[model samples]
Target: MKAGFSAFERYKMKGRFKWIAAAAAVILCVGLLFACKKDKGKEQEDISESTEAQAQAQASGEEGESEPARAEEEDPNKLEDGMMRSYLSGLPVDEKIGNRRPVAIMLNNLEAAQPMSGISKADVVYEYVVEGGITRLMGLFENYDDLDKIGSVRSCREYFVYTALEFDAIYMHFGQAAYAVDLLAQDYVDNLNGLGEAGDTCFYRTTDRQAPHNVYTSASGIEAGIKKLGYREDHYDGYKGKFKFCDLNEVVTNEGGGSAKHIEPDYKINKPWFDYNEKTGKYDRYQYGAPQIDELTGEQLSYDNIILQYNKWAQLDQKDYLAFDCHSGGIIQYCTKGMFTIGTWRRDVDSAKDGNVDMAPVRYYDMDGNEIEINNGKTFVCVIQDSALEDIVLE
Candidate 1:
């Protein structure tokens, strides 16, 4: 009986120990679950706080942290206002205007045609000797919508036509020299001649000036002539610009360059010169002992860049029609920001055989063989005879 009571007591004690172990195990599991839930809640709180801070930062316009992502997707060459860079001026312009082909109009630079109308608006201007020690002007206008009177239109020279080709411009003139007739009649030359069938529609004589110097073309007349001729109004599909320009916001000082505060291209006639204006950062033009003012605007003509392109030239015939070596390489002097630099200008002569010569731009390179950069504005190019290079004075 004593041994049976001892076994029963041992069994009861074992059952109590088992119950206590199971209760402790359940309490430990509950505590672990609560701790995991608290940890998950803290993680969610951290995420919520981070998002809220970002939103606040954005609202306060302190979004510098996110700028890198936005900048990565933005185009460095394009302006924020959806304006396109102009091929001629390297300035912001409407896309339609920027993409259209520029017009190269020949202007009479005789003393009788002083104060030329609409000349100040030209994106680029070329001055070269025509004949009899006289100089003629070829103004390239990229945007001429508001120009009422563009020129006292003059005849075209073969060399002027080639210069116009460099810009892929629609060559415009009242007439052409005999030497230019064969070249102008070619299919590649898209010119609006005042002496041709489009004459009545594209040009008119102003009573304010005399016969040869009175012939003028307006913006409407140019548009009408282009529409009547059915010429392509836009630039070529793969037309990269002729010039490489600096950014609009940037200014190139031409550091350590030669002084170009005053430029005098001493032609036998007209005697054109330029004075650098510190206030406007442009070269103010002067010719025939006075400012080269625009008749319509009453404003003097100015340019951001001045290029002296020296080329081998010759008189073609007894009539003295001039021919310049446009296809050949030549010495070039580029001036801007009151300073000047020497460079070389070249064009691929082989391109002429491929019928794509006009599409090839005359490239400019420094002595180091690197392409030179031009400022963003109107340019004045003086096509001087290489023999007369010493006549040019840059003070």
Candidate 2:
């Protein structure tokens, strides 16, 4: 019985060993398959990383690639908005900037003349506070199509400082010059030589079209330039040069839309001085009429008379007087002394005091771009042209 039990135990032991060996082999095969799968996944991940790195390096212009563009930023306007957009991180232009980003709407619009195409003599006139010289002379003609080939003003756009309000820039050309010229103290013509013409290229940036072009030379040339180059008014139906000029006497709507009092100019600039002494002083203020360089010139005019004549006109017409000096371009032509001086004489006071004029004469200059721009000695004419603003007229 004992021998039979020993045989059964040995057979059971062999069977158990065989089963354990088979299980071990299966475990080994599973481990090898998992290892191969991990190795293949690692290889694929490396290839994907390499491709991504190569693409980044190309965009950065590295690895013998062409150099990226140097930053050449220029301010379109000194306005706060312009500066913010160009320099700030989150600006529209900055967000859309390269890696070859799409062009902006404004940039695209600027490329097209659509913003400027439609203008009329009555609708818009982009005025410039310009100095005389070839710029003013050439500007008088406005758009020169023949000169456009030579970089006429058309190559450049304009920003306008409407009356007292600055930074409200509009894209104006051609008839725009007319508005600027009319406000520019008329003495701009007198200062042409002071602007200093160089060989052949135009240099005045504030006034000239762009640069390096001298297509027109005189007032007639300026007029021709306007016609030949197709003025903004010519392109658009509603526009006329009239929008450039404003009559101080006329009441107009507030475009920017604000209080009618503050926004609507009271011609207070013209009468700035009138308010000063009218309240506290005598009922009649003193202003000298027709300030002349010569006390005995009868008409009270300078040796060259235009400046003094202008001052005299100011006294009579607007009660605003200016002095003339040799320094003032237009008034200098009429200087009696090397420097002529003028004062305000209240005519109303003078009449009451038996020709005794009350004066508040000052030394003024044109550098400030005031109504009286010349040295306090120079005067300006208050010549107001009362013509109908262009009412949608065309040739």
Q: Which candidate is the best by TM-score?
A: 1
Put down candidate 1 lDDT per residue, 209-320, tens digits, no spaces. 7888899999999999999998889987767778888766566666656788999987888988999999999999999999989999999999999998887665555676
Candidate 2, run of 10 with poorest lDDT:
100-109
Q: How far is candidate 1 from the true structure (C-alpha RMSD, Å)?
A: 32.1
Query: lDDT of each prediction vs. the true structure?
Result: 0.79, 0.20
TM-score of each: 0.80, 0.15
Q: For this target, which candidate reaches the highest lDDT against the unseen true structure? A: 1
10 residues in a row with least lDDT, candidate 1: 32-41
* Model 2 per-residue lDDT at 16: 30
Regions of candidate 2 where Cα sits further than 4 Å from its true position? 1-158, 161-217, 227-235, 240-395
- Candidate 2, residues 184-208, lDDT tens digits: the string is 2221111111122221222122233
